[model samples]
Target: MQSLFFKIFLWFCVIVVLVGVSIETSSILANYYETRWQGVLHTIMPMEAEKCARMYETSGKQAVQNYLDDLQRQKSVRFYFFDEDGNPLLDRSAPEVVQKMALNKEGLNRIAQQNLSAVNPRQGIAMRLVPGPSGRKYNLAFQQSPTLIMPVSEAVGTHPYYRLLGIGLFGALLCFLLTRNITKPIVRLRSAASEIAAGRLKTRVAPSVRRRYDEIGALGRDFDLMAEQIEALVAAQRDLLGDVSHELRSPLARLIVALGLLRQASPEEAPEYLSRIGQEADRLDKLIGQLLTLTRIESGVESTQREKFDLTNLVQEVAADGDFEARAHAREVRVVSADACTMSGAPEILRSAIENVVRNAIRHTPAETAVELTLKQTDDPKKPGALLRVRDHGSGVPERLLSDIFVPFHRVEGGAAGNSQGAGLGLAIAERIVRMHNGSIRARNAPDGGLIVEMELPTSWA
Candidate 1:
């Protein structure tokens, strides 16, 4: 019973077997009460019946009844004696079918002419006519042995239990099929779960399970989805650890070298050594700060509260900041085209992202050139949003490396990883923050020269 297959199989088997037995019993009983008479046994039946009649004539009705009773017990045969007019000769009750054959002389003659005695009690009954003490005819009816003709007027088969055995085999087959249909999918799912628990993050349910159009299919699909997300998060985490350690090692080594130089240097050289140490410490701090920001945004810990603000104003403000910083490098930041567009997002977070892009452009633009910005709203049916473009008039990033710019610690070999350049985390942080606001960002080489970064974002109305 503890096994579901056994429980279901046994219960179904029992119910089916019971139903089969009931139907068989009902069929046998129906045949039992049937009025149709079976032909004579041609064995001890009519002969014994003649003895019953002679015994009745010699010893009277009671003694004949006793003799007949003894035969009934030993032979499983019932004897009925009738006079020539269809009246009972013995003090015993007979079935109505027997009485009917006796009363209908024509029907009785038709059967008797053929030397056969017709009787009821299901099959196996027989009848015969004999002379009585008064020199008149007598009809004697006796049933055949029930064991030979049992359960119906039809004769018994060679084997008594064949029907029951067939029914049992059919029930077992049905139960086996039913249990297999239900438990097969469950077994697959359990195996998948076990594999996953053993650190096989890529483990998935079989296609057979997933293709099923039922709740189990839905569960299988959801399980695969969860595994996919878990794998992605784990890989990202592992990469982050490796990148952080690699980035930290460089600055630490430099700081250690600077500390050694400072302690051994003369008074005049000490300040320079100390300053070098300070710069490495500051760079290390900035790198760590950007890492924290990226982690927060990626981990969904950063607040995403939204507010409506003018995109034009935010762009102009960022340009002014970049321009002020650029002035020292003989460069300028300017807004080329501006359209007043309102958008919804965490304003400070978006400000950081936009500022990062603008400053990166300013740092890359040539000393005599200007970094250009444009802001406008689009009404495309597929994506109604505002598109902001920032262009830097310097050597653009390599086309092959454009997509890599947003990855943490990614830097173009000869374009932006110079000794004086900032750590390559500004664009990475920008990408994460922009993604948090449900915006898309990408970079491409400008037509004439330099590089253009475009950000498409939904406006408040959109």
Candidate 2:
């Protein structure tokens, strides 16, 4: 997997697993040998003790000591041989852990007891009795599991090349942590980016990264915000696509049903089915046209041919036309103030944007309620722009769902105008066109009663 955490974890696991398995295997084998040697000592210690007796009588203490020394090295068992009176056969010291099995009558001093307190104790001392050649008894006491620790070279791969590599890695890791405190966050961001690129829209930078006050942290926060917007857009697009399919299916299905009825009908009923078929065809055409307009606006195709035009003139023209259309339905569209301001963009597309908003308001406003339009140049230096406000006398959108009105095919299901008569691409197209022109569109409820749709267009364009 292309996972940073997985990669790092795998690396650490490999090193630990290697070291652990090696040490564990060595220890297991060493323990097995230690056990076998302990068993063999039982069968042979007495024989060796008797041999020591003969060696001391004939050869000398030196020869017996040499013999025991060889056995200690070969069998890896520590020995402490003594006579019946408790004198060591060899001229060598033993660990205090095993000294209790063979001690002098005078016993150990207080200093020795305290000094040896820190010494680790073995399980027990293995003792064997043997008959001397001169008929005296001698005691052989030894400890099990004499150290089987391997040399550092063999145990740790301390060959020249490996040693250099290990040192280099250690130094690099130290330098990396010291010099690149930001790398981890960058890596996390890269990982998050990769995750999103792979279609995991919800993937986000780790919260630890976001909590930092540095640039990397800011980047993480921005990255997460971008991810959220992208996820929302993708979800909205998916929903729009599904809605488009469903919308298309309804009209196509109605057309099919109408055609079937027309085929089975007598001449008298054919006219009704033909009219119904024509109505379905017109619905499909309008939906498809609206879908195409939305696509063009979102893709910036409609606004490609920028031209200087008077927004005041554009607003008045749309108002007059909307007024004429609305009056037929007992509603009216009127301009409150058409401020004389000019801007560069596609006037026809901008015209479409204004028309859509006015039409929506007209559709929702009660009979005889005027859909009011306001246009003015804003004085805010940071955002010098032209603002348009369209207010309608109707039930406002729910506070929580005000922003959703501009989403394709999303309608505010309130009041008389909440029907699904439209494909719901009108405000969505207008929203995109305004954004492409480096402007913004937003809707909020007026304080009195009704919804206000605001559009802000920048004066200058790049």
Candidate 3:
């Protein structure tokens, strides 16, 4: 793929060259016509032919013919002469034009009315009529300006085509060179990103071109800053996990050893001690597993392999697993779905997230209360998404603690009063997993009197 900077530079150069060439070509053509008009005016004399006729003893046809020939040789000029009756006495235009004008009476009348000094300035042709040797006779002189007669097509010939070809070839070469110069740093940045994605946390874009003070240089600086931050955060997280694990390991090992010793001392006390030890071990194991899962997700070591799956099946499975736990608390867990729903994401992660919500509901609800697990697909066809909700008919979470419910290790004061079985990482992990799939999880108190945990997952197939 091409870099953004190179594309922008290419478009900029194209616009600049096009506008420059257009203005230049227009100016050149205008100046050419202007200079030719000035030259033609300098060479020809503007006088009434009647005045010339009164002064001259002989016919002035040869002198006017010679002037017309000289101007025609430089460019292209047509000349014509008419009498008092508007008859062409002397015509030196091409044979075709002479024949056409001979048969045109209207043209002859227009020429008579135009008479000598009366000429349209904008038109290329100029005319002057004078009295001949007799008062009844006249000399109508017609001279076309060289500027308007010269054809641009013939003037350019082949030189302009060759010049344009050369310019286009040179421009392409310049664009290639510029694109290379701009994309070199981008290529380096891309390679560094690939390396980082491949697990090389130290990979970074070089700042060797910082002195250039361009977009590339700015990008290099930004890339380096981003790399540094990622490295620091990763290192700090690893260190914190390591320290927390080490601190927990000692006490956990000691408790297991103490329980073994108690079992050896009294066979009757063994059952109770063994059960307590099992509970402690389960708690420690859950905490360690949660920490590792959180770390993997946070460090980007684990990515969700999103794919379409039946939301109904996932909700049913999670609710089934949490049913026994709800039964132990004398609460009934019901999985209700009015319609089949489909969602996209890592199925295992999504299952875990839903299971956590169901487990939380079951743990918080009072005895004989019902913990409802509902799956609903949105009605809007354009906005296709599945909502998995777990609602418990118990003293719901307070308004103040609702916002912090999804935060890691944050347990509600009254919610966790009776239950010490969890380390309060379930909702946090659920939230992280949901967000990884580009979904959202929220907790709120239902108006009917219970806390509802809703998870919304987007799906392509509604």
Runs in model 3 lying further than 4 Å from the true structure:
1-243, 246-271, 295-307, 416-419, 460-462
Worst 10 residues of 2 by lDDT: 111-120
- Cα lDDT tens digits for candidate 2, 138-224: 666666563433233333332445444544576566555534655888899999999999999999999999987767778899999
> lDDT tens digits, residues 116-172, model 1?
666544444566666666566677777555563355324223334655555567667
TM-score of 2: 0.58
Task: Quote the positional error of residue 449 for candidate 3 in Å.
Answer: 3.8
Worst 10 residues of 1 by lDDT: 151-160
Q: Which ranking of candidates, highest lDDT first?
A: 1, 2, 3
Models, CA RMSD each: 12.2, 13.4, 13.9
Cα lDDT of model 3 by residue, 24-133, tens digit:
76447645655655554434523434444543436466665565556557755565655545465544443444334444545545655654243333444444444455
Please list the C-alpha lDDT of all candidates, in the order they appear: 0.76, 0.76, 0.67
